[model samples]
Target: MFETLPNARRCAVLIAASLAAMGGAAPAFGQAAGQTAMPDSKAGAAKPKLWDARPASPNATINLVHLLVKQGVLTEDQAAGLIKQADDEAYIARQAAKAASTRADEAAKAANAAAAASEPKGTRHVTYVPEIVKRQLREDIKREVMAKAEQENWASPGKYPEWAQRIRFYGDIRGRYQGSFFPTGNDQFDALHFNAVNTGSPYDMASPYNLPTYNTTQNRNQIKLRARLGMEADLTSGFNAGIRIATGESNSPVSTNQTMGGGGSNFSKFGLWLDRGYLTYQAWDRNLVASVGRFDNPFWSPTDLVWHRDLGFDGFAVQGRYAVSDSFTPFGVLGAFPIFNTDFNAGTNLAQLDSKFASRDKWVFGGQVGFSSRFDSYRELRLAAAFYDFENVQGQASQPCYVQSSSDICNTDQTRPLFAQKGNTYMLLRNLQVGSWNNFGTTSLYQYYGLLQQFRPMTVSASLDLGDFHPYHIVLDGEFVWNTAFNRGLAAAGTGLPASVGITSPGVALNNRAASSDGKTVGPFNGGDKGWMARVTVGKKEIRQLGDWSVHAGYKYLESDATVDAFVDSDFGLGGTNLKGYFLGGSYGLSPNVWASLRWLSANNIGGVPYAVDVVLVDLNAKF
Candidate 1:
């Protein structure tokens, strides 16, 4: 049993044997062995020694059990039993410590399982990540969110309807300050108001004091506005439609300006007219187009010599173009436009109930052919020739008419022009017979005038663009017009001279070459029949971006019968033909879609009474 004992127990046994041989007293290990033995004198008896009742350490218990055997306090058999009991208690303590360690490991594993179960599905458990990877992930998330929001219109979901995607809207507005400076030596009375005389009651030829005339002497200043709104819709299959409305003082084909304080002031609402409404169809690979409605001019005119810029043709027009090569293109246009339509109930006289006038519907047939030649990418030239023929637009003399009272109607009253401006030769329409009423206080023949000569104008236009400086160009334009149907002999015969009832001067003739007041002997009618215009520009074609600019200068000379006075440029000579002028203008872009312009025009009458006008215009324009 001793050989099988551990080394620590063997050392304890050797130490106890050595202590007994030396006859040394046992050292007290703790309070259990510190008490000294005592004797009882009265009883003459020895008391038992006290011992600690707690469990002892393994080494201490072995030492204490050996000491008891040496001191005769316990027998050998009992000492051996105490030694075995100490060993057994130490073994039980070792088992308890191993059980506690096992329980702690199990508890840690259970906690780990619970944490994993509580996490969301598909979640990655990353304890550490790089800074660059984190940043890249954030950027990717942001881009994805923005793309989704845009696709779904998240800010205002479903706000835009499907049909709105196929429509496009456009408009522009302009405000102008204009000053008309008339020279001091203008003949105010000579410029007759032909429109007022023809539309209203006939002017009294006997009394010329109350005749309507133009304001040629008075200098006027006014503010004007022009606004247009338009939209285009795609009908698919190379078909499209458009409509536009604009501000106007009246329904005039040559202008859309509305005077700021006109039309019965007091903050009254101005009028809006249909400026354009058209439906067009394109075929043959978009080279052929046909339009039927009030639409823009189909002819490629270099300048507004024969047609006003704001005029729209109400009829059918077909335009065709063929691109022969990269450097050349040929185009042509053919259109027929109605000038005026006689009323269904022509005659309005109660005296002659069944006197209906003949149908005198006026029309114009025009054709143009043009070609564009591109010298290079930055240089081009365009040339065009056109012919416009007027049908049923001339006046005829009426047969002998008896106008004893105001209720009598002339047979050829409808022959007079529906509208006319200055600078056109005119002749009296009524041929009155001798009557007793003419000798009375009031004249019997109340008369109106009609255009003397017929009109069939031939025009040639050309434009050359030099674009050596990119985004800017130097443009040269020229146009010439000649009235082919002007006949001086016929014009002289149409004006009834001495046979007319009212003995009067030549009524509103374009030229002063006429001789007699009562139109007796026909004089040489030196009426002008040709007109030409030339212009030069150095600027961008359009003012779009900020800081863009352009400047232009031009000269115009239009004859009395070169083109219709009512359809010529309205700005020069205050809206008429038979005028020569020079104009200088410049425009600057203030911001995107906004611009400002200034122009000065100095014009004089080509023939007839002395008339001159200088106009200055300042304009602010905006578009969207």
Candidate 2:
């Protein structure tokens, strides 16, 4: 047994020597690493001390105890007790190791699960693509995309051509059926007397003794069409060019409607005129813009009561807007327009009499300053003050043209052209000699001396938009215009004229010249040169899509001298000033950009003869 177990043999030798030296008594052995030696027994003790034979190594001790029991040197009960204690300690240690390994496995599993949760969805894909190739792929996708942009020529396309991408086309067409009703009495048309017989004589003070044989007031109905085509191109950075053409007669500054039955129901072709052709440049980070060419009016016109909608200015304009905050902005506008040009070529010699005479060209200069603010997303306000000054728009009232051979009749057919229109009161510079006509010595007819009254008009306009009204919004707008020159007070103090020369009497006749009290200058209409208007519109602000609607109803009072007659509302009071009326209109959208509208204007003369006119229009309007 000792040869089979080296440690057991070594421990057995130590114990045997200890017992021999102690005279066969239980010897006191030195304690092992942890166990205390059993107390020494008496020299003649009945049993030997077993713990003295215990070894430091557990396996060695177990082997020695088993050997002693097998050789019958120790009892079975004693050996079994030592073996049982050793087995119990080994079982506890094995269970502790298993518990630690389970804990480590659980921790490793938790870490792996946490790593999986942190990763992005889908299987991880790794690629070795070059940086340049990846960047090119991104750019290619970007270039191929044109969502939310205009796509032209849809016949064949994933997208429009490169050049086509920079251009946009849009237009509108309107067809209108208009009915005009006028007063039926002849007194309104043939009330005044013209003195054709007497030279240098005042108009005949004729009574209404001989009424006209027929009622001359004619009510007419007509159909008219208006078409427009326009294009805009983005040139570069902040610059753009635009052009528009419309159906109208050239130089007809007020109306763009082409009447369908002008010459006895012939298939008349419409005349296309250049409406707008302009180049615009945006500066100061796109807050300031300047435009040159024939362009839309640059002034802020809240209503057509002051400036007509179709009136385009042929010149240059500059506009600027500065934002002080998110809701407040100030703006300014300046413009110069050429109304007419009169430049004639002639040599410096006095031999040619007709060559050296030419009227100065007419020009109009305008300026405006204003500010706008938004209270919130639902309300806004705009206010502006504007001034317009006209140059070379004045002429003598009796601008008569005479021939050298025929001096008696003063040649009524030969008359100098004067800028006469419906709204303006053309002043007659009576007997004021001008060099353009042949020297006829001073007895010119009033029609020949019809001078365009140079108007310096100042205007104030404002609009308040109440957007929160939802389906029924409200807009209140007001405009005031004062023509400083329209009703110029006549200095009639010196001429020997009658005291009863009122604006309505036969002394100031409609046919011939109405001499001023001083026979020098004639005043405009009786009232002063001031006009004002206020309007309210309650409806949808815009009709953008299908099922959308908008409506407006307003009244206007336009005095004769309020604004230039040629530029005032063309549809109001038959296109002139000194008119008061009410207008109601409404529109219904068919598609996003197509709609129809109806409007009616009921007007009457303000202070003149008893004349009333009513106009109704039904229109179909479309845009793209």
Candidate 3:
């Protein structure tokens, strides 16, 4: 129908048809559908109105105009102008939407910041992680890293043994310069046997009643070295094994320092001693441990007042600790250590009736029960009471004779077998008045008496620590010991006699029975049986580098028989009991694992004999 209509009428039909195709309704043109004629606006005498000139629909009109251009009815410039106008509007809409989104993001961020700033301290703003979950996370991360490392072969494939992972090794070395000074030593009890003749004499000097050679001025200096290597291993069934090797002689139990420039040379190779080798079984959630074999000293001592740090024990010990609360723990230690081993000769000799002349070996049975309480992380206190009873520590024999002598005669008062004395007061059990004459020919033969007392020491020690007072710690510790046997020996010194001459065995008797020459029984009560020590330390807990320091000072008064003389400090008063002294020391760290220390000891005999000994030591220590 549009093809048969006039030009103006056909154009109107095309515009309506295009608008209908584009999904828009065309406005009524006021022409009936039955009537074929249509008003022609472009050919009217008056110019068309603005509304009549405008297209019926913008989209359809644009499409119709494109069709007109393609059909050569309109020029290309007219079509290009309409397309540019549509592009500009679409670009403007995209810019406006982008600006709106940016504004929304800024407002959200500002609100979040304001809320965070207004939140108070201790507010539960974050999801909390419990200790258990944190621990689990740590374990998981470790396992995952380990698994990845294994899969990727990051570790050595076969260079090291698998058991190496369970082993830990540690060691330390110390180089020391020591000096000893003695001035005007007057009439001190000579325990070092300086007066006795050994090389020029015809016999070994095994006696204790010998008089002092003569005290004079003595000064000495030497360099010493102490090195130790230790290794510990984890074992099956909650057991662990450890071993330590140190530079010292095997027989010296109280010292591990090896003197330098010995053996008539400037430099001599030192020897290594087996300091410790032990196996420990852990039970009761690792609070209790039972150890056997040669091990470190099990006694708890804050200082070397009662027990030396180098002293090792060959025995078994059981240590246990119970935590009653977070800050209070009670602990106990029980141990049995061998002191001396006696040997019984076979019955090959006809002079002796039987081989079993003596009884058993000497032993030490001891234990300590203690309480450790921590008021907080900054303060602590420990108090322990201990009892040590020695069995067969004192020798038991009436007569000590030498086989080299032609007749059955007691050895000289200066050359008899007795306990090794290192300055402790040892009362002569046997009457040596017969051998008072220097000439051996004038002496009368008599049976000798052995040691007459057993050691049973009761000790109480305590320590307090006030941690981190600024940069230093305040540590105070003290010890008190009462040797029950000391008074027994003193009582025997002036007493008369006992019913019998104790038990007749070598290092096998515990009962102490002393009889004087007149043969009268006496009671057992005397004095001189106490010892005490006190120390104060103010210093850093540990030295990590330069400018770190610690200082300590201590005073100790040891009675004649408070503790074994052999086990006392080897450097104080030249090592032994019956000595009272003051020691001052300071340490400075050179590096994290290296340090230097200086200690000075000024000691005098407890008997007030005007004997003064001063010792100074400077040491450089390194640890790994």
State the C-alpha lDDT per candidate: 0.78, 0.63, 0.65
Give the C-alpha miss distance for residue 359 in model 2, angstroms.
4.5
What's each prediction's TM-score?
Answer: 0.71, 0.63, 0.64
For model 2, the local distance difference test gives 0.63
| Per-residue accuracy of model 3 over 1-624 as CA lDDT, tens digit each | 556764434455665676578654444565333232233454344453333344434443354545444333335675566556555655786899979977975786787668778988666555355697699899999999888767655575764445676789999999999998887734444323421321123222233245334332568888888999999999978999999999974347778888777644556577888888999999999999999999988888887767877788889999999999999999999999977664454123456555234444678899999999999888999999999988765533334443333223322232222334344433332232233342442333223333335578899999999995847899999999988765443334433334232211222221122222353343232224688999998988787678789999999998666776667678888776667889999999998889999999998766423457899999999999
Query: What is the C-alpha lDDT profile of model 1 across 162-281, one tens digit per residue?
Result: 456567899999999999999898877667777787877877766766778888999899999999999988788999899999999988888899999899787789999999999999
Ranking by lDDT: 1, 3, 2
Residue pairs in candidate 3 whose N, alpha carbon or C atoms collide under 3 angstroms: 398-448, 399-448, 496-516
Q: TM-score winner among the candidates?
A: 1
lDDT of 2 by residue, 231-273 (tens): 9998888899999988864446778787887643578676788
**What residue pairs clash in candidate 1, if any at all?**
none
Model 1 vs. true fold: TM = 0.71
User: What's the TM for model 3?
Assistant: 0.64
